[model samples]
Target: MKDVQTCLNAMTVDVEDFFHVSAFDKIIKPQDWDQYQPRVDGNTRRLLDIFSRHGVKSTFFVLGWVAERYPELIKEIHAQGHEIASHGYAHRRATEQDRQTFLADVRRSKNHLEDLLGEAVIGYRAPSFSIGYSNEWAFEVLAELGFSYSSSTYPVKHDLYGTPDWPRFAYQRAEQIMEIPIPTLKMMGRQIPIGGGGYFRLYPYALTHYLVNKYLDKEKQPYSFYFHPWEIDADQPRLNNASAKSRFRHYVNLQHTESKLDRLLQDFRWSTMKDVYGVNV
Candidate 1:
């Protein structure tokens, strides 16, 4: 986010517990999701309050179910001056299901957020950046569902998600719907992704700063940086079944998060995702 603040002048916030991920999907059922409410919600509130104090606004990709149960949380986020976008109803991966079901899920989540926010909801980012080559139709679904843009594709090669062949910078897809691919720096003819989550956790801050600056100097595009509220909450309960890989990815830089964030806020200008891509209101 510091890189984004330094380079793009904005950040995107995705709200979800560590367990809601695909690796732990087998363990946590929809009925059991509420068990994590107290921890996740409180931590999220802290994040919102922190951003509020900084006077930093962002585009919050909220889960629809969370919005339904915690409408006040949604209101609180908006009240503090942030843009609201959908993260689908239940955090399902787009490629895991068929096209029609995926489309329905998009529409369901979109409508749910628009109703709660009382504003036109135009953005939709798939859970885990799940929309890829297999689910390209997901974009068509988003357009049909009245969504104006999507940040669902990460333009890199990853085991979980990314579309290396897609355009790396923000651009209009087919002249109507927009595709805001995650920020990537082209190196030696290869697109290397250094934005958000794992990159934020594993890589050193200096490298991230250099990478974002490199992109700005060369590519001249806004670099997208994303983070979850739980990331900054050092005390968030660890998912018991999280594997070694998951554990490392989740916990690597917890202690340094707050400090890093402070540096980030100071280094660059930060705005909401909408503001970066020129999304109107």
Candidate 2:
């Protein structure tokens, strides 16, 4: 295991509520999203407080819908010295939209975020890490619109999204866009997810801890960890009528998230993508 003390990992947050998760799309239509109670503001504030207490700054991939609803919240995130990146307008996956539609969404989100902060937003994270081999065009669009980098690929096999064959670390694409894939560890001839999200919650904390350090020692690369604001909000409203799998993935171990996060934050140095990678964004 590597000494985990000095490595500054890329800490990121997908700033969306439970209702905005892709797993609940079949049950909770986007049109009905407004009718549901909005819990993102409070949940995100709690995260900000935790980061402040730990003296850690992170990148917040803000959904355009959330930014539109809570403009001041976005301003506050920026004011607090956190990096703000686009998470697209609506939570739609790239594969779900055509090239024209995808470009529009990217432009709309980037423009909105840049307009709010009066500074260029150079980073983006696709909703649900939806950019894979089939949707490679998305990166070209991101570069064309002035985004310097994207953390929109999860290099693992999954039903929802994955580019299992993509480079598992940060690399520049043909379009001049830097791609920072979610962290994964190679073991037993396969890549296992050690990054964050449901995997972090589902696995024992000890295993996740070991895997993170192992990756650090072997690859000498800082991990890019991500989680949603809703992950730590244990008391947030639960979605009704959702499938058993979605409920299990979303609700399991919610109560344990904050404590585990505290340990991880203390164990690893954390910072925004731009700072850790020294990208001029």
Candidate 3:
């Protein structure tokens, strides 16, 4: 709540259906997305309405596959004056493949999304925070793909993704790509998750709420917060029967999310990440 009201300056929205999550790796294939239920359309539209009400603009990191299939959504996001970005052609994480594979994914996805939106896509984020330590070199691929900025690194350590060694606040020119690592606040001598993804969902909103303003008071850096539309839709069916830990991570705070979001809107002066970081290029 405090982050949105007292500290938040930018938001990043990943446009993907629920099933595209890596936790469903075994059962889901790209071709199987058609069978995906309810689609993200309704949920995302609600999200847009909320942002609209807040007069907030965010960068929508859309999947090329999703954008290709749902150009209207991409168009709508752009029509509303937010930036359109690539979240890869399919939803595969960059860590799922080697450099060659990751390059291909970035190249193809960029081409596809730019074609659909009829504008150059300037930013990219991996499916999950897929460009952690080992694959930090993937920045070269993104720059080569004609991207000028990226938001794929998470400045924390985690089983699925994060790069603790990476800069916590937004920094740029590493790999010649302006990198906007996801929002995190320093805690107990280490970085903590407070921006988006499972961390936002799993933790108590009060805790996240306090941490954001606490960091802002101490550090003076604008905070970044993110959430998916699927998260706001507490009833969005569990996309897969994920592991106990993953399930807890993904679904822990679904019930309290909407109220928490309402609280955030009331509290924060939120906007998109690029404006916060000054990455207008």
Candidate 4:
């Protein structure tokens, strides 16, 4: 039996280019996304190579726009033994879409992904972690569309998106699908966000290690951590006109991400979400 210390945590990548980030939504339009230099293909291939070096398999929540533009990339990700899941079409937030629009977006993405892989896409994640109290009904659409799980809720409070009052770990929602709120812990009566993304990039490696170990040893729960390919591309073009806060969040520690990820992969057991959660993909 595997030791609890080495139990697998879910490692995920939100596969979108540097320019597709939600931070620049006001300054950039989806129609103009193509105008930006595309770096996702090369950046994601770098992630696949890194995971390969460590013998780690990951779940890739691919944007439909990226998949349509690079079907071969999706094929190669699957061929390399990584799980392919939808990151929604258009990268629109759930709160920004009504039920019908959200449903159509997810269905379109899933259908295109399944067609490309010849297999069911069982997992999903909302862009910008936008499935919150206002859009709780989004769960019904996810379940109806045959997604078995979603990692869309971040329980920590954020200006853009969060359901801080929601369960901090994975829980079945609407009795149809599992809603895995990004892993967090209560400290000093405040929810501390530890489940990767900007938090992973912002926090020191020792603190991240301590936090993950606390979950493993005390809570006995494997954490779910996510990152985007753009996080590691330190040399990627910068959006100079973005707001100061958005610029910092998007660009902070870009040079340190890959090294931190290397340490993370080596220090813990990681696997695809389906395998870690026991959901067949």
| Model 1 bad stretches (over 4 Å) | 1-8
Please give each candidate's TM-score.
0.91, 0.98, 0.91, 0.97
In what order do the candidates fall by lDDT, top score first?
A: 2, 4, 1, 3
lDDT of 1 at 33: 78
lDDT of 2 by residue, 64-182 (tens): 99998899999999999999999999999988999999999988988989899999999999988999888788988999999999999998999999999989999988999899999
Over the stretch 22-43, how does candidate 3's per-residue lDDT look in tens digits? Answer: 7666667878878877468887
Clashing pairs in 3: 4-268, 5-267, 5-268, 10-271, 10-272, 10-273
Model 4 off-target regions past 4 Å? 1-4
Strongest candidate by TM-score:
2
Candidates 1 and 3 compared by lDDT, better number:
1
Candidate 2 displacement at residue 243 in angstroms: 0.7
